[model samples]
Target: MYGHGYTQPVKPPPPAGLLVLLRVLFLGIAVFSIGFMAWAPLLRLAIVTRKSLDWGLFVAAMAADVLSIVLLGSEPGEDVRTAGGYLGITLLLGTLAVGSVYYLAADIRHFHQLRYPAYPVGQPRAAAYGYPQAPTPVPAPYTAPNPRQTPPPMPRTPAPQPPANTPPPRPPQRPAPARIDQVRAELDELSDYLRKHDEGGR
Candidate 1:
C-alpha cells in the first residue's frame, strides 16, 4: 500500500557487489589503456595487429586512449620535457578517469534497460521477487428495482394514552410544626407538681 501508485513492477537491481566490481574493472581497463597509449609505439602496434586480441575490447581501449590524448592536446605547451609533458599526462589521466566514471554509469543504465524494458500499456506487469499481483476487481452491473412488486412497509407502533378518569399528579406535602401553647401548658403542670411536693416536705 505504501507504494501502490508504483503500478509498474519494480525491476530488481543488479547486485551491489557485481556493480561495484564492474566499475572497478572499467576503471582498471581505462588506466591500462592510458598507460598503453602513453607510449606511442605500442599503441601503433596494437592498431596494426588488432586481430591479435579481442577486436571489440582492443578497439574500445584504443578509442578511449586516443580520445584522452585528443582532450590533452588542447592545452598550449612548448615541449614534452617541459610544461607540455606534465599538462598532457595530467589531462590524459584526468580524461581517462572521468571517462571511466561515465562508462560505469552508462553500463549500469544499459544493464537496467536490458533487464527491464518498458511495460506495455494497460497490461499489468508480472509479479516477481515476492511481490503479489492483485487483480483489478470488476464492479457489479446496476439494475433498477421492480415497479410492480415492491416490499411491504414496516408496521408502525402507536404511543399509549392515559385514561380520562386518572387524577393529575399532586405536589409533595410538608410536615406540621409543633404547637407552642401545648408545650407551655406541659411545662407549667410540671412546675406546679414540683412546688406542691416541696411545700408538703417543709
Candidate 2:
C-alpha cells in the first residue's frame, strides 16, 4: 500500500530468454543425433536475430559458415577421390558440432542484452515539463521592541482548590418530637369536643 499522497508505479517484468533456451535445446538435440540435424541450431539463431541482428551472433554464424567450407574443401578420404571425401565429412560434422555450441552461446549473449541493458535508459519522463509556480511573498522586516513601554503583565488564573473527599457530619434532628407535639394538640381538641357532647347529652 502507498502512503498519503504518493503513488508507486507497477514494476515491469524482466526478459524471458525463450529464444536462448530454444537455441540451446536445438543444440542439445543435434548432439544426440550425431550431426544429422545440425542445421537446426542455425535456423534457431537466424529466427532470433531477425529483427535486429547482434554483432556477436552475426560473427559467430559467419565463422561457422567459413569453418564448414574449409573442412569440406581441404580433406580427402580413403575411398573417395572428391574434394569433400569421407574424412572431409567427419571434419565437417565436427565443425557443425562446434557451430552448435558457439551459436547457442552467442544467442544467449544477445538475449541477455535485452534484460540487462547497456545504454542509459533511466532518464525521468517529467524532467522537461516545467509547471507554473506561485511567487513567494516577501517577509516583513523585523523591528526592535521599545524598552520605555513595558508590556502589560499577563493575567494570572486562580489555582483550583482540591475537593474534600468526605463531607462533615451534620447534627441529626428528631422528627418524632415534632410529630408527637402536633398529635398532643389534636388530642386536646378531640377531648374538649367529647366533653361538650357529653354535657349536651346530660
Candidate 3:
C-alpha cells in the first residue's frame, strides 16, 4: 500500500573522442570570450604585445584539451583507437582555437581604437556632448517679500461612510445535548464488551 515504483534509464554512449575533443575546444573558446572581446582594454593590451590576456586564455584552452583527451581515452566502454583520428581532431581543434582567439583579440582592439568617450574633462564646452547643458531661466530677483499673499491651501479627501446599521451574521448551531449523551453511552458499552472479551480469551 505504501510502495513507489521508480526506474533509472541507462545513459547513451558519448560521441567519438575526436568529436568530443572538438566540442570541448569550442567550449573553451566560448569561455575565453568572457575575458577577451568582452573586456576591450585587456584585448587592446594583448594586441600591443603578442603575450597578453589572450595568451593566458590560449594556454588554459590547450591544457583543457589535453585533460579532456586523457579522460576520454581512459573512460570505460569508449571506442577510440589508432593515431589518425586522434591526430586529426587535435590539429583541427587546435588551429581553430588559436585562430578564434587571435581574431577576437584583433576585433576588440579595432573597436577600442575607434571608440571615443562622450565626456572629457577640461575640453571645450561646445565640443563636449553632455557638458554644462543650457542653464534654466530664473524668475526676476524676488521683489520685496509680500507678507499678505499666501500660497493656496491643498485639498483633502473625506472618509467613506459605512452601510446603515446592519447586525453581524450569527455562527451555526451545534448538535443537540441528547444526541451527544447517546453517543457517549454507545462508546461506554463498546468499551465494556471489549474488556470482557479480552479477559475471557486470556
| Model 2 lDDT, full chain set | 0.64
Which of the two, 1 or 2, has more TM-score? 2
lDDT of 2 by residue, 7-101 (tens): 68634433466554665588786677556456567666676666444444445554655555565566554345665555555655775667677
TM-score of structure candidate 2: 0.35
TM-scores of the models, in the order given = 0.30, 0.35, 0.23
Q: What's the residue-level lDDT of 183 in candidate 1?
A: 78
Q: Please, what are the lDDT tens digits per residue for candidate 3 over residues 43-155?
A: 33344446655666555555555554564465454564646446634544554456465645554453444443353544434534335665444446657867898967989
Q: What is the TM-score (0 to 1) of candidate 1?
A: 0.30
List runs of model 3 lying over 4 Å from the truth.
1-51, 79-106, 114-202
Worst 10-residue lDDT window for candidate 2 reads 120-129
Poorest stretch of ten by lDDT in candidate 1: 36-45
- CA lDDT for candidate 3: 0.54
Measured by TM-score, the strongest candidate is 2
